[model samples]
Target: MFLVGLTGGIATGKSTVSCMVKDMGVPVVDADLIARQIVEPGRRAWKKIREVFGDEVFLDSGEIDRPKLGAIVFSDIEKRRALNKITHPDIYSEIRGQVFKHFLRGEQFVVLDLPLLYESNRVSSYLYKTIVVSCDDELQLERLLERNQFTEKEAIARIEAQMPLDRKCQLADIIIENSGSIAETRKQVEGIIKLLRSSNHHIYNRVFYGGIFIVVLTAIAMLMYWIFMR
Candidate 1:
């Protein structure tokens, strides 16, 4: 599978580009979704966090108080690393599983949507290109304020928590400037996908022939218990 790493700073329209890519029927493995799944009330991560940080981090509904926890973690690098130490492995495991599933399905291309792609060191080596959606700091601040109802300072805090956009863009294989309209951004995504479909022969071969082995193994794993139990 051709696996592209997608990333951008907070509120820089990464979500918009990801959605558009999905809307156009490309398979996307969203790290954010996986992160959320791993942190739900009864999940191992949640239980561990509760044990470590105690009850004050939970709400009346017995769920982790994300905002409260975020406040503490974001302000301190050690705490931030501690939180990531708890969550990143689980999320990465989930991501690997999903990508393998997509590969087994004979998919020619897939996107790994990770917000902290560069910050997390996920972009250093990849099977496919890395794409960074970016906007200027001022525009990012404005868009974040409008989208999340965050004050300018609040948005800046979140943005500051990430590496600078310019640095991220410099690392990207493809820099998608998302400061423009939806049409412009979508056009860029569309053009990139179209070129990739025509240009990537290795991916075409993997999907056409090698993927059958993957699919058969996945099927065996999924159905083995049913067959053996009977």
Candidate 2:
């Protein structure tokens, strides 16, 4: 399957682009969805988080209070890193498993929708191409404030927590500027789908298989290491 990494800064309309990609009949493996799934109350990641963050981050009903946890980690860099250390391995493993299933099923292409794609970095080397959906920072901040009902300061803090939009644009193979109408954005996404469909399939297959091979080996090694350390 042709693997594409899709990412952007907060409030950059990346989620809209992901939905567009999905509507076009190609599967989009959502990192955010998988993230929420892995953190449900009974999951191992949830237990690890409770152990590190304590019961204060949990709800009365025994679920993670995400906003409370977000208030903690987004304000502190080290705390955010600690959280990622616990959650990211499981997230990546699930993403890889889903992608592998798609590859085996002979999918023509698939999108990996990630928010912190560049900050994480490891998945970048494995994708055939990367798309960064972006808008001007002023608009991004405005959108963030409106969408999440956050004050300007809170929105700015969240934006500053990730890599800059300009830097992400530089790293991207394709940049979708979401500064216009929804129709305009849809046109851009459709154009990308057409381009990917027209591109050489063999090249994509080579890159995907080569990348997934290393991913499988690394995952196996890490699992063994975790088992031995335990």
* RMSD (Å) of each candidate, 1 decimal: 5.6, 6.7
Specify the highest-lDDT model's number.
Answer: 2
List residue ranges in candidate 1 displaced over 4 A.
Answer: 204-230
Per-residue error for 155 in candidate 2, Å, reads 0.7
Query: How do the residues 18-104 of candidate 2 rate in per-residue lDDT, one tens digit apiece?
Result: 999998998999999999999998999999999999999999999999888998999999999999999999999999999989978
TM-score per prediction, in order, is: 0.86, 0.89
**Colliding pairs, model 1:** none
**What lDDT does model 1 reach?**
0.85
What TM-score does model 1 achieve against the real structure?
Answer: 0.86
Deviation in angstroms for 148 in model 2? 0.9
Question: How well is each residue in 3-83 modelled by candidate 1, as lDDT tens digits?
Answer: 788999998999889999998889999999898889898899999898877899999897889888987787787878888
lDDT of each: 0.85, 0.92
Off by over 4 Å in 2: 202-230
Q: How much is 1 displaced in model 2, in angstroms? A: 1.8
Tell me, by TM-score, which candidate is best: 2
